[model samples]
Target: MTTGVERLFDELGHFNRFQACLYFAAIFQAISCGIHYLASVFLVETPTFLCDGPSNITHVLYKNHSSSSLEEIWTHYKPGDGPVVVQTSKGDQWELSPCSKALRLNVINFQYDFFGNKTMESCGSFLYDHSEVEQSIVTDWDLVCEKEWLAKLTQPTFMLGVLIGALVFGDAADRIGRRPILMATSLCQFIFGVTAAFTENYYLFVVMRFLLAMVSSGYLVVVFVYVTEFTGIKVRTWTSMHVHAAFAVGIMVVALVGYLVRVWWIYQIILTLSTSPFLLYCWKFPETPFYLMAKGQYKEAQELLDTMAYFNSLPSTLKVSQLKDENDRALLKDTKKHLETEKRLSILDMFGSLKMAGRSATCWAIWFIGSLGYYVFSLGSVNLGGNQYINLFLAGAVEIPSYLIGCFAMDRVGRKKTCAPALLLAGVACILIIVLPQDNDLLAIFLSMTGKFAIAIAFGLIYLYTCELYPTIIRSLAVGSGSMMCRVGSVVAPFCVYLADIWIYLPQLIVGILAFIIGILTMLLPETLGEPLTSTLEEAEALGSKPYTKNAAVDRLEMKQSIKA
Candidate 1:
């Protein structure tokens, strides 16, 4: 009997196909970006702000807690007044504000013993449970808008989650299979997102946000890995570029929704919860063919290749035995001895031999700064000082044309030259925005638009460029590491916005300068537009074979040889 994979491969033949499969980023980012995390950032709590105060009492400690039954807890009489005196077991007396304005009017006081466990018992809000009471405290305050220092507290940490996720999740993807991780994250994302939406306690919300961000890490890296593996080399670059552009599209899409749905928390619920469908459906998509090959699931890989061949309307070749799943077993079984001999992969491997530490460092710096500046400008869509969604939509619109131009020019002029100037000029555009008067709306918009345009171009070029620079063996790892660097920029992006409130443009200027320096440094690298992908770092450096060095005479001569093969 034919196996399941073989049958699946037969059915896949009817689908549209290219030299390689193209899983557009538009499919991922547009769906994922709607999270309130991307849109309404205002709900994030600030922990530093002092809440227990005389005037602030009117704002409600918990909310709607009127208690006449606290008479037993009171010693210094207050039949109707808001303030009362309560006596402690140690014979000390203190004047305390009544729970009249608090949401939990029936709250019972509790004390802890030396080991720091709850020792004394108390009854709180007879009508409400502990969860409800905690919820009351959560919903009761607007710490940041109220100028509470605690509000500033949450902002710093919100970013830390993104950073930690970027690093930790890279390992997570490696240790666990992609399917399990992606599915687990999707379930957790939905749960945490819901918890975050309704959570009344500030700390609880913060915890959820961190969890949400942490799971988000592998999502980015995995999507690229998936798309890159499934696609043919001819269309891979353009498709990868589309994935990031999908993120931008997501930003714009969510910004518009955020504009319409002004209730920040409600918006968060919508963004996070809405994408559940996409993730659920994504579960059905096939695993990466290369990942299968590596795992030694050669049969699966063969079946997948047949599916692709069917999709492309090409005849399927090879027997079922030949189509083993490389991944389902040992990826480098033959090389295991060599790996054991070396015991480790070195950073020096990136240089191939000459120790191109300077070049590697410089490239990483460009990757980092390009990430930073790109975010500063792209996310600055929130700062457009008008309809945020409209500005975001318009900013996003600029990319379609810019990408089309890039897709057109990159293959023509080549990679490094085109990418470098785009980055450097993006920096200049950022600086221009600072000097341009905020009141000169037209010039400001123009300069800002130019900055965004450059960022989009630079961002697109980086993905394709990094992939080209690294050879196939370490291609995924190199790109993923560079992506991890982008998370550093992402973590800081929020803090920069916070600082913008104190000194507008200061952050942008810092970001711009960094981008310029790195962009110029990127020019130090070599170009590889038409060359066959080098399979190892050593081959990458040797740089044999000029690409497409076709003479009409040689092409005509090759036509005769083609008949012999």
Candidate 2:
């Protein structure tokens, strides 16, 4: 018998204007999230700077020499007479003194004062070049020298908020319907994001940013679920992946915004305000009919289906009676009972069977590996030897083709075939960077972009693959638990960039090995292409054990009913 959801999908029609608008609305949130999550990459950039070298010289130069001559004079004589070179812990060499002699101001004129005491002193303040960026967190707060770690910690701190948000919000999204959570999070993201721009202190900025990240993370999860719930099985994968594509578009947009706006605060304000329209527009979209049916709100479900039908320019043929007619009423009651029965299913239950245990563990590992690779490639852009803005933009742009390729390949070759090789390719690309000469920067960058593309393909495939692996009862738990691990990977990504100080290739090597190992493990998973979605734990375990034809799941359900009888 057709489920109420099936009937609703049939009546409402697929790929209609109503669903299209909803997808666009969801994409708006995706774009905002992409910008917000990575905004720190540009806002806190460390530009070329040196100690405010001898203000006395600057004073005299301004009073005597023309402004045009100042640059020429400063450039000529700034190098130390005998440079005090120091090697960093990472074995890189740097000069201790920016200038050897301090220039002096005579009564009415400036002089280079060559005979002035030649001594090196620790820098008290810095002067940044304003040619590129007007102001960054690095410049505003002087996060150089001993405070450099503060700048490096910013991404991780926001990621920590994401970690906390995933734990709390994923559950909240499940408990409350997806729509309310989305609305609340949209408002919170706007408020906290705007507040972050005006924060006077670094700590306060971190706090506001944390809250913003938390809400933004919730927005991601809720929107993903909300969009998935409304879409039919035929168009579901594309609809969901399109949100991720929107995220890539957001990254490019942020790169453009950052390129144009030189000041950190202004860039932030632009991103924050971009979310304002979502606050009002979100209300126009209705709750998913599935959630309404799950909560036993049959009238609301019918009303929503009817509205969808009308908006789709189809007849309002769906009715409440058609949903709970005698047969489906019992089925609906059984579904409610089934949901209640699965409520007690714990994380331990995910490992109840051997095949399930292996599947869960392998998928979890792949999630961690994929997430680690994705963020490491993305966040590592600032460190790449090129125009940071251009590098960041390319990092995002490279993923677009991967998403497109994934959408095409998964349907033809199946999830395992596509994902396993994608991981291998990503791993090989990252490892290849390790052998390339550092002087061959173009090759390194090309390899890095290739790795990102491969990882993006794997990342998209894993979401679909994971969804197919678990039964409906434990689906949320399985995906949520896996996402928690993804957050852990994100939290660790910043440290990978930091480790570049020790060995530039260390992070890549680690991620590469993990990817290759996980790729092998991914192949162990059963191919789920064209198989019916598993509705029960038993069916999930039995999936790859036999020839899973169209009615196999139904046959199992009938067998269970007969045994009970």
Candidate 3:
């Protein structure tokens, strides 16, 4: 049956100017999340570097060529093909070994070692190719060679913070309200993001990045639930999917900004500053009526509904007397219920029964696999043998059509069919890469992009499908738990990419097998295509096996009787 708030939504007109304003306002948060999530690709990129030569070589060159350019003088010691023959200021050509310096011998008589062994020693410092990225954490903190593990740890650490944020903010929103969490997270994202840019210490930078990611995840979860509650069923799928489309746009923006601003700190500043407009949500946004009604705050729910009706230019069928009557009845019912049961709803409640447990497990597995494949392809895209910026931009660009296709498929074919096939297809695409010729960079990129395309579809579908699968009371908690699992997959994604060193095809092979298995598991989930958003646990548990009717006639009859009374 439709809840009181949902019935009011039907009368007030779904997808009106009020809902439109809120939907667009929430898009900025999604964009900010996209930028922050993938900004590390450029922020920590490893540039082409080599061991700097010995100090004696530098001193000798400086003494001989007093006014010579650094590039001209360093050419004698830098790596190159054969020995470089340089014409000195005296108009004499001298042969210089690129990798070695002769002791107690003339510079002209130095011979280059081309074949087997040379006396190689540990580098005191390193030289980097700064054509692409002028500076990054790798260059600034020397997170290369022996210290490379620290560079790899940055992303997983950020994801860990995101995981914790999902748990904290998810439960808090359910208990307190979505509005406060949403506002607070938005403000904190800005604060931590900008603060991360200014920290000179690498560990301090990582700490700030972790905090920023935490708030970003919280903001994303609350905004999704808040918008989902306000939207009607007819347009919910597209609106939710569009939020991710906005996310893809943010990824593309990162590529653009990363290309234009090669300095890492400056890029961070710009990305965080762009999201400052979203802080206005505190002043403009309203608390969702579904949450109010679920909490038995009928008067507050009715007032919000009246405001919605006024903004949408519709007649308000609810009256103060009707709200008071319902409130009184609800108070008495709650008084009796509280005496009977003291248990509260939580993420654990989703697994309270065997059937619900089975469904929740399937949802969790799907989330895990989806996140793993999505991020594995995302982080590996930059290394796919082309311009990193262009490749990253294409990675985000391909997702737009994927989300559109997912929206169409889920709307027409149902959520199960859409997500399952997409996962299977992504698996097939990734696994096929194992057989490609080693030198075929173009074909390898094509298969990788194909995997990204299919996984993007599945990734987008899971958010909308999970929202529809759970009831309103525990909806944010369920999504948050699912997202927490998603972060677990993301936390492991960097290691998955690192697996390429063990075996060339290892990463894709792993991703493929996992996706294939989860694709089959996804079929066990209930189809939530056209169902009303269930308001209670009993209604949610009956989703797949039971057939529900909106019963417009009965709802109108009840509204008339309540108005008359």
Best by TM-score: 2
TM-score of each: 0.69, 0.85, 0.80
Question: Which scores better on TM-score, 2 or 3?
Answer: 2
TM-score (C-alpha) between model 2 and the true structure: 0.85
lDDT of 1 by residue, 136-183 (tens): 222355443333455555545655676686567556655665556666
Candidate 2's residue-wise lDDT over 1-565, tens digit each? 4444444565676578788888788778778888888898888887656555432232223223333222333332333343223222233222333422232212222232234333445677776667777899889998877788888889999999998886678678767888888888888888898898998878899999999889888888778878867776567777877778888877887888999898999999998886588887887768877668668888888788778887899998887677556335545545764776666578887899888899999999888988889989888876768777787799899988899899999999999999999998989988898977887877888888898898988887777787778776677678778887888888998888778879877888888899998899888899988777666788789877775543442333322221111
* lDDT, model 2, position 544: 74
Candidate 3 structure lDDT: 0.74
Query: Weakest 10 consecutive residues, lDDT, candidate 3?
Result: 556-565
* Candidates ranked, most accurate by lDDT first: 2, 3, 1
Clashes of each: 35, 0, 0
lDDT of 3 by residue, 408-497 (tens): 888899999999999999899888888878678778788988999999898888876887787655666677688778888989987888
lDDT score of residue 470 within candidate 3: 75
Could you give me the TM-score of model 1 versus the true structure? 0.69
Worst 10 residues of 2 by lDDT: 556-565
